[model samples]
Target: MSKIAVIAGSLYLWLSPGLTMGQRTSGLIGVPDTSFTVHSAYSKAKKTHPDIRIAAPALPPTVQANLNVVYCNQNGRDLHIDAFYPVNQSTNRNQLPAVLLIHGGGWRSGDRSQQIPMAQQLATNGYVAVTAEYRLSTEALYPAAVHDLKAAIRWLRTNAREYNIDPDRIAILGCSAGGQLAALLGTTGNRKELEGTSCHTEQSSAVQAIVDVDGVLAFIHPESGEGDDSRSTSAATYWFGASKTEKPKLWHEASALTYVDKSTPPILFLNSSVDRMHAGRDDMIGKLNALGIYSEVHTFADAPHPFWLFHPWFEPTVSYTVNFLNKVFSKK
Candidate 1:
């Protein structure tokens, strides 16, 4: 019907033939109505929503309402993550699902600060939540980021007891570059090279679902029509130390869309109408649908690229994220 929808449908049509190793093409786009009016509605709702209020600061808060902080020194290099468990001061320390969160900053500059607050809120909501920090692109590239997240999952599993967490229920949450890392973990299962620097424990980083916050999907798909190359040298382009044209394979390998398999986790793509990178998220969703894998898309109104973190306290996204996680963890 529309440009974006047409592109999505066309891609679905191409992939409907199933997973065959070959080149498939679909060039269509539908521009849905994304207006500022919707954002105003969200902003208005945020003002009165009870959940919009952020819980106070905490070292590793047991509850978002209080101050309780904790950390882990598991992996070498003082590597660790912050956690928030139930603060009832009553229930056993073993009744919560753990969520591994990654922050986004162009794959080069984010910290757990982006996720800590939300994790703390989740912890308050009867789930054990963690905000982990991993090595950045400056230190490594391509699979390295994925490697670090896998290691974090392993560490959480190995120490689940001490942390009062449920390892099997762990899910990855991230935004932008962090979102890409989460999707990577969700799709790529156990690999020999990414073996987490451990011989004692074998923690499979297969998450139940992925929360992809405005993350890019395919690196190879250029816009169909004539346009400037804003896609070049993008937020994730140079991570491999290879030019876009020189390392075509590397580009595909790093793409989360390239690793979709039967074992890939159900994905929830949170997007906006203003950014092209995220605009292409529908492509990945279409691919997932063709494979019968679980996936959903939530397009934010009027928000532009680089705005997810702009208003960390923005109630609209916060509530939506919480609800999404709850559904992901539901028994149904």
Candidate 2:
């Protein structure tokens, strides 16, 4: 166990009591609601802190995390995976499963650090959680993010026993852009991507489950009403890299809904009313039902996207997520 991990774990446990009821339920209960406090804590702790807001508030033997663990170091640019897990043993389940997490920032500007509180809660609840980083749209687009996330999974699997993780039970969770990637991982299933280094190992990067928090499921949808705000055309243009009509075929293939086969992993979709991209989440849910995939969408009446990261506002959303996970994974 690293020193930083120990410190982070202690901090999370100490501050868990500060969370509101909703935050407590979700299991991610430590982030301060006030912007100033958050700003101060974030800056002071910075890369040294591990753990994200978490679920399973009652679970014990709390652990902290490290900001970035190098998975792929190449050309002076390192591809990292940040992790949160238990610091010591818990008799409930000595070894924890994993939630392979990714953050959201339109695939262009998000980092692994944002979800420390969430990851910590997941760890406390008997899960080894990782919030991974990959190349972004500005640096590289399309499959770059996919490949990096896939690589992170492979790394986790290879070292599962060391981390006390259940390799077969690893799941993927993402928010916003990250959620889109998680959806993609679910749709892609166990099939390996063609990119990345030829590491001479047959490790698998496919996920057993997915959690999509306000993701983009279909780039072009028949149900799309004119002038709807699922996204700005310019943002989509930058992301999709072609007009909807110009790249219709590619866009559909890339969408999570298009690839929702029977083998697709179970998905938990979290939607917020205020987000413009909520429609995409709905379309994905419809497809999940059509394909007989066990998918559930929890809609917040008017919650803003990703606001669950905050302490006060996120309490309920966090609880909802934990209960959903408990119900879904209990059978598996």
Candidate 3:
């Protein structure tokens, strides 16, 4: 384990030594309702870049889509996935690789439809692409969303034949809060504790590649601006059910940086110019290098934090993801 991992695992242990096992902490603050939709992001971006516009939600003619398919039923709560694939599927062709897209809304406000445009583009590019819905902080707490996403991955693999997808060639991508979850899913692929009870126990939740778009890798790092509740409750605080000061353990445990090891798959970080958005990223890449794992980073300088939601940046985001997925999945 690295220094960051050590800190991540033990940050609050010494501070709360007398706390009992599985003791539920309470009185944690919550944030006001905030919309994290693509429209909201585009509206915010348009303020700075007037010419930038939102990406169209239409799928290309070459793509076939199956929307609102139930991928998991968690205690009767059904989670859905929207799958997109090539329209002209030939029986003789090889099984297509797949990419599962996760939406970012600070783990509170985003929806699966936010990833629809990107999924469409990926499907048009000869891959089985999907957008998944998970239990957000508003609906549940930390590990619930994690388990939900892992279930989505397993669902993709379990139904691989039906979707013409290669069970082993799946990638996960997320923006902002979704990016954090994507990275966590990638790094903790083998950790049984993080795999919450969902459907498809026989299938694996591991992803072959990860694309983290403008998401923080660590919540407790010096570079991280998370948990700052001076003006309002930060999104990280909202998702974790407590402020970083009050529940450092949850903060550490949720960080993707805490779990990165040699077993971690290749990662591609698509970031904005905002340094805080990519907190703990440099250290993460450093660790990946030492572990002999492949990782890539591309910063869109001066771009809005929600660049993936808008026009000019959206195209390159998809392009980088497609290229990276091809390179990493090709090794299999």
Candidate 4:
């Protein structure tokens, strides 16, 4: 194993406590509602060495990065995607599965650069990974970001041959706000209403699978609780352009839970044990089960909402993600 993989494996063992021998043998480190009690230790360690930076592991020799390729032009703005893929490979008929990674910032702030490491890692593992930029709430409203993502997907399919990508095997992955968008994209596949006239109108915007990390499914549900209050207004209120009471239909329409059906793609949810962070997750999982669509949730014990971005948790997060994608794409 690589050095980072060894570190991550050791960290997982250290972080997991109270696990039965059977559970450990099964490699199920996450248990619902089990709080991770090591936050203070990490906090203290950080304070003692405040300048330390936890960089993501480097990609292997087989992977290569293609940065800032414009995928669409919307309202005169050119949206770009940073792609990563394997080089000089004869595996899988010289075509690899693709993943579109979206970053999280509550729809207000965040950039595609936030997901570069993740895209690189996925590429190192033999998939074509693209991190894309979309309009934020500061620039537009609910469907604009969604439209940009759909355009990205269409662009990937349109240029699959150039990138050695399997056009039909693309999946969507996102964190926090991006997670919400990924869920929406997965559920609203080919829905005419959400397919704004950005670009690539003739191509399909559907994804084959979804990976949501700490994203909200039902924005207006009471279980969602309060989110980052530092802003003058709630993120959802800004994104939807109105309070829930003022535009109930808009709220419902923007929710991923509102569109779930038998056609929805397989989904894998990686989340913190905090109930409010993953509000409506269980409800969506139940719906998927009822429809016989595959869905699973793995909750990290007491970890923070941004666990996927940092060390110790990042590796495990990617591990689960790759395993899930492998399972889903193999079935396809």
Question: Which candidate leads in TM-score?
Answer: 3
Model 3, TM vs. native: 0.89
Which regions in candidate 1 have their CA more than 4 angstroms from the true location? Answer: 1-76, 88-90, 193-201, 223-235, 310-313
Count the clashes in each prediction. 10, 20, 0, 1
Q: Predictions ranked by TM-score, top down? A: 3, 4, 2, 1
Order the candidates by lDDT, highest first — what do you get? 3, 4, 2, 1
What tens-digit string does per-residue lDDT give for candidate 3 at 194-288? 88766897889998899999988999999999889999867777667677877789889989999888889999999998999889999999999
For residue 27, what is the lDDT in candidate 1? 14
Instruction: Provide the clash count, candidate 1.
Output: 10
Q: Give the winner by lDDT: 1 or 3.
A: 3
Q: Can you give the TM-score per candidate against the true fold?
A: 0.71, 0.74, 0.89, 0.82
Q: Mind sharing the TM-score for model 2?
A: 0.74
Pairwise TM-score winner, candidates 1 and 2: 2
Deviating ranges (above 4 Å) for candidate 4 = 1-55, 89-92, 226-231
RMSD of each: 13.7, 13.5, 8.4, 15.5
Model 2 residue runs over 4 Å out of place are: 1-61, 74-76, 90-93, 192-201, 222-233
Model-by-model lDDT, in order? 0.61, 0.64, 0.84, 0.78
Q: For residues 103-203, could you state the per-residue lDDT of candidate 1 as single tens digits?
A: 77666566765676667767766777778776554444455566667877776777777666666677788877787678777777675644445422466
- Candidate 2 lDDT by residue in tens digits, 1-332: 99999987775544332222122112223332222233443454334333333222432446867666787643345777787887764344555778888877666565777666677777777678887877654444355566677778888888776677777788888887687778887678556542355221467877777888877777677543312324654434444445556556656756787777777878887876655564466666676788787877777764545545543445655566667676766777
